[model samples]
Target: MHLLIDQGNSRTKACLYKEGVFTDVVLSELTPTDWLSIKQGLIGSVAAAEQQQQLQSLLPASLAVRWLRSTAQAFGISNSYQQPEKLGVDRWLAILGAAALYPNQSLLVIDAGTAVTMDWLSADGVHAGGWILAGLHTQQRILVSATAQVEAAALSLHPLQPGTSTTAAVAEGAKAAVLGAVQQAIQLRRIERVVLTGGDGAFIQQQLNNNAVLLEPKLIFYGLARFIDNN
Candidate 1:
């Protein structure tokens, strides 16, 4: 079994993959103890370069690690970024994963975890670029920190109707900011499907009403596998 790991801002998803198939998936916060105990025997692993370095430093010296990277074009998708390498590997992998899942289909891939990110992929596999906005928790913290009197609000999807309480108002604002972005992206292009992932993906999908949606939290790993295949 090959060790597969994807490290994100808050946690890392680890699993065993043999011949592109994953088994025994695990999720753990990026704690020292967590990294120190990774199973040593595995064919190899893939992750962001910086993350890979950090992971390797905590593993056996001979462990094989492959850094996931962004390319100008792959899996039929042409990246529109002027400097494709500047694009986040997570975003790049998400785009690759989306195109592979729905070839020839227009998509707005939204990952709403640490930050809310959306990448548009044309029907013919051209990445039209993407946007980054504060995620639910991030946005709430920003709002509360900026306004001394504003307190952190509980996350509950409330109606768009006017909020009567201070906490409710803040909650409503954060909801609007995120939900609005998702709605706008759906209407911005002839998006055939909205690919949602991340912590808030299900909430976004619930609010989307009548739109096709796919929730795959492990998209980056799948893309890593595909990228390894074609490159």
Candidate 2:
């Protein structure tokens, strides 16, 4: 079995894949200690350096862990960044995942987590760059923090229509901002397919109300596996 670890800002997702399919999945604040049954794995992380070190220290010495990073070019994907490594590993992996999942199609890949990110990949495998913005909760939190009078409770729903109350306004406005950004990105390029991943991906897609939008929650894991197989 191969363990695929996607360690993000708030949580760590671990999956066991064998024969091109995931057999088990776990989500936790830190890597679970009970994964000793696996012998090899790939880690695609956006956590702090210190945190990553802690993760490495906790892994079994017998387990082989390959850390995935961004590059100028890999597997026919040409990164557009002037300094490719400066790109976030998660975004790069998502782009790789999108390309591998839907080959020969212009794709706009969106990962909506603590922060919402959108990356574009051409059918020819060119990284057309992307945008990053505060996520739904982050936007609401910022508004609450930045202003004194905007007191509101946690949002129960996100409505595209104008909100009738303070809480609704805050919640809906954040959703509007994210949806607007997605629409803008789609207009900026000839996106043939729109793939959504991350925690808030489904929410974004639902708000957009587009049946064409795809939710691929396992995109990063697929990218990790593809990168490992190629290299």
Candidate 3:
């Protein structure tokens, strides 16, 4: 059994996989009991140093842990960044998952977490680079912080209609930004597959209303499994 941990800016996911298929998943830090019988583990983290160490301490000494980092190339995916190591590991791993899930098809992999990241991967396993933007909540927070007039409000998911009030306008604007980014990305490239992952992926898919778009929240794990296989 292998434990795959994807530690994001706002959340951490620990999954138990047997033979490359995950059997269990936890959103918070795993207990020592959770590590029982696990022999090997892999962690891909973009969290703070303290958070990383907190999780690291929870693992059993007997378990061999591998910290996954961005590289120039791996698992057939060629990263396009000039400094490949600077590429976010979460995005890198998600691209690996997208490549394996939809082989030979150009893809737009969107990970909508604390920040929204959209990475384009070619059919031939080449990463053509991607975009990063303030996420839905991040946009809202910025609007409130930067402007004195904008106030925080609980906004629910609604159709993209013109807003009548200040709160409504703020809500609609944030969502529109995400939609606009997606539209611009697709128009710039030929995306054969659109895969959405992360916390707000469902919202993007719902707004897209495209039956072809796939929602795979566990995409990072798939990438981790592929990485393990290559090793």
Candidate 4:
């Protein structure tokens, strides 16, 4: 059994895996006490370097823990980054899951969390790289910062239409920025599918007009699971 943790920007999620699947999942903050309580078990974390180091220090000296990273190549997919280490483990693992789950499919993997990322992978297993942008809340925050009038808390996931108020305007603008990028990518290529995941993945998917898009919130964990299986 292994304790798998993905310490993302906004929150930390941990899960238990045995054999090749997740037996349990616990989403919470990654704290000193949390990692300290695990007296025994193989632990793995895909997180920022600092958080990983802090947690490693709190673990029992005899226990085993490994920090996951993106290598030059693993699990059949080639990383597009010239320096593979510079690429994010979360994105790399998600690519692994996408390749494993949808073989020979051209895809655009969009993760919309604290930030919005769109990665393109060709049908023949080539990672064409990706783009990153401000997340919905982040966009609203930026707007609020730039102008003193509107409140950041006013934004919401309203329908994608003309903005009737300040809140609607900010919310729609943030969503449009993300969707516009995805739509442009879809228009530019013969993308077979768009796999949306992350904190606001479902909300973004709902506003999209295309049937090719899907919301798979647990995609990151599934990708992590693939990495663990190969090890």
Candidates in order have lDDT scores of 0.74, 0.85, 0.87, 0.74
lDDT string for model 1 (1-231, tens) is 455666777666666555767665543333445444543332122345686567666555555556556779877789889998878777888888888878889999988887899999999888998899999888888888888788877777645656788877888888899999888888888888888888888888777766498887767766766744333
Span of 10 residues, lowest total lDDT, candidate 4: 37-46
Model 2 Cα lDDT, one tens digit per residue, 21-113: 975475332254546667677999999999898878867777888998899998899999999989999999999998999999999999999
- lDDT tens readout by residue for model 4, 111-211: 88888888898998889988888898989988988997886554456667777778777778888887888788777767899988888888878778569
| Model 2 weakest lDDT span, ten residues long | 23-32
> Per TM-score, what order, best first?
3, 2, 4, 1
lDDT of 4: 0.74
Query: Least lDDT summed over 10 consecutive residues: which range in candidate 1?
Result: 38-47
**Per-residue C-alpha lDDT of model 3 across residues 155-225, encoded as one tens digit per residue:** 56676888788988888888899989988998899989899999999999998889778999899999888
Off by over 4 Å in 2: 27-36, 152-158
For all candidates, what are the clash counts? 0, 0, 0, 0
Q: List the residue pairs that clash in candidate 1.
A: none
Give the least accurate 10-residue stretch of model 3, judged by summed lDDT: 23-32
| Model 3 backbone overlap count | 0
Score candidate 3 by TM-score against the native.
0.93
Roughly what TM-score does model 2 have, to 2 decimal places?
Answer: 0.91
Give the Cα RMSD of candidate 3.
1.8
Query: TM-score, each model?
Result: 0.84, 0.91, 0.93, 0.84
Best by lDDT: 3
Question: How high a TM-score does candidate 4 get?
Answer: 0.84
